[model samples]
Target: MLSNKNIIVTGAASGIGAQTAKILKQQGANVIGLDRHPCTENVDQFIQVDLTDPQSIDDAVAQLENIDGLCNVAGLPPTMDRLMVMKVNLLAVKYLTENLVAKMNDGASIVNVASMAGIGWPQSVDAIKDTLENATFDNIESVCDKHDVEGPRSYFFSKEALLVWTMRERWTWRDRGIRMNCVSPGPVDTPILKDFIETLGERAEEDMKVMDRAGTAEDIAPVIAFLLSDASAWVRGINIPTDGGMSSHVMEQMHQFAK
Candidate 1:
């Protein structure tokens, strides 16, 4: 369904981004792979990007000035300092989306790779709202410097901001006929796994026990491909969880505990 489309897959050098890029290409989408690390497979062209800097992101988007879609699959685990994670995941995203909005075809789609960790957004919406409202070009470094949100909070907050921003973006771009959505995966076995496991410690492993089985990058890529194609034309600004039943299971446990 994506044949002839121009798509950018950030963090495409490894893990989920790499897999998604490969799948998108297999279905005939023209793909641009962007990452800090160089990738060895599944890309038509590679563009090295440092998503933290506005100038860098602007330059990168300008490079893909003719692209049709974007898969914002780039992110860092909790191990990085809060500012770094937020800068890479949220700030860079805001800058790129604003700049790239003009480049996209009216029907083009944006697929952001959030995580199950971010579904806590409802309770934290107020905080996220503040974060987004304050997202200025020069203030990202200061905010990260101030919050010191390193570790899990940085990763968590970044995804939450992404989820909310994309939803609002849906409304902002409704008149233009553009679409946006997010994919949330749980306990995926990727190169990032070691970082998550080490940073999250025992709790991360415990969280995995609920699913009993981990998902593969292959499992999540197709759903992303679906959201990016004409098949999902009517879909807009929804966060789709592809974590088997893990997210639902978490809800169940929360409900039980509330009792």
Candidate 2:
């Protein structure tokens, strides 16, 4: 479905990013992989990038041209430093996308890999709006402090802000036929799954007990691939929960719909 397209995938060194690159290549894309480390996936090109650095992102973006799709998949886990999490998970994404959007083809798709942790975005509207308006690479530390986006909360906050940003930019590039969306995955069995369990402790255990199994990168990659393809041309600015019904379960609990 992605034949002849040149797609860029951040975090393509491993996990969902690598899997997404593989899938996109299988579907005939010329994949350009980006990550801090060398990509293990056999993409057409690989660019080592430090998502935390604006200069690094700018240099990487300069090398990109005629891109058809971009998957913002590189992210730091909550166990990392709070400020760094906010930088990679949110700030860098905004910077990268804003800079690269101009180089993308008219019908390009941009898919952000958000998390189920971000589902609480509706509850943080004021903070989201505030961050969207004022947060920049220069003042991210102060922004995090003002919003109490520290510790593990940084991960949730980053994802929440990302979802809001995705929706807000739904039509920002409609004139050029470019669209953006997100994929929110539940706990997936990646190398970082242990980090999530460790951070959330019992809450993570309870969530795991209620679910039949954790998802895999394989499970999440196809949905991302779909969003990157022409098949989803009309589906803009939506977050597809690739989370094995965990999102539905959470909504049921939130609304008291489960008997």
Candidate 3:
């Protein structure tokens, strides 16, 4: 469905990003994969990039033109420093998106890879809003530190911020017809899956039992592909859960517990 369209996939070196790049390529899109290391998949071209660095994003954007779609799939797990997590998962997204938005053709779509960790966004709205309003590469650490966003919490905060930002920017390019949305996956079996399992410990195992299995990149990529295609032209500002109904199951359990 994305035939002949030129799309950029970040974090394309491995995991979901790499799989998404391959899927988009099979759909006939010209895939430009970007990562700190070389991409060895279905990319037509690969650009080395450090997503945490604003200058690197600027340089990468300078080398591109007439982009049709963007998959913001590059991110750091909570295993990293909190400040670095904020930079890679949150700040860099804002920086790269703002830079690339102007260059994207009309009717283009932007898919941000969020996570089930963001399902608790309602509880953190105020803090997330504060971070969105003030977090920059230079000040991301201060913002994260101020909120005590460390370890696995950093990953949660990043996805929360990203999901909220996606909703907030829904109409940002309405005149140009660009749609911004996010996909939230549950415990996906990716390179960083172990990090999540390690961090969440018993909670992760409990979650796995509830869901019966962890997701695969293939399981999530199709939804992203649909979001980027013309099929989802009317969908906007919504976060689609590609998490095998884990979010729904959790919500139901929460309701029962509250009663």
Off by over 4 Å in 1: 141-150, 257-259
As for candidate 2, its clashing pairs are: none
TM-score of each: 0.93, 0.99, 0.97
> Pairing residues by index, what is the TM-score of model 1?
0.93
Local lDDT at 54 for model 3: 91
RMSD of each: 2.0, 0.7, 1.3
Per-residue lDDT tens digits for candidate 2, residues 106-150, read 999999999999999999999999999999888989998898887
Better structure of 1 and 2 per TM-score: 2
Model 3 agreement with the true structure over 154-187: per-residue lDDT tens digits: 9899999999999999999999999999999998
Candidate 1, 22-120: lDDT as tens digits: 999999998989898887577888888888777777777777777678899998888887677888888887777778889988888899999988888
Poorest 10 consecutive residues of model 2 by lDDT? 38-47
Give the CA lDDT, 0 to 100, for residue 47 in model 3: 88
Candidate structures ordered by lDDT, highest first: 2, 3, 1
- Model 2's number of clashes is 0
Taking the candidates one at a time, how many backbone clashes does each contain? 2, 0, 0
Q: Against the true structure, candidate 1 has what lDDT?
A: 0.85
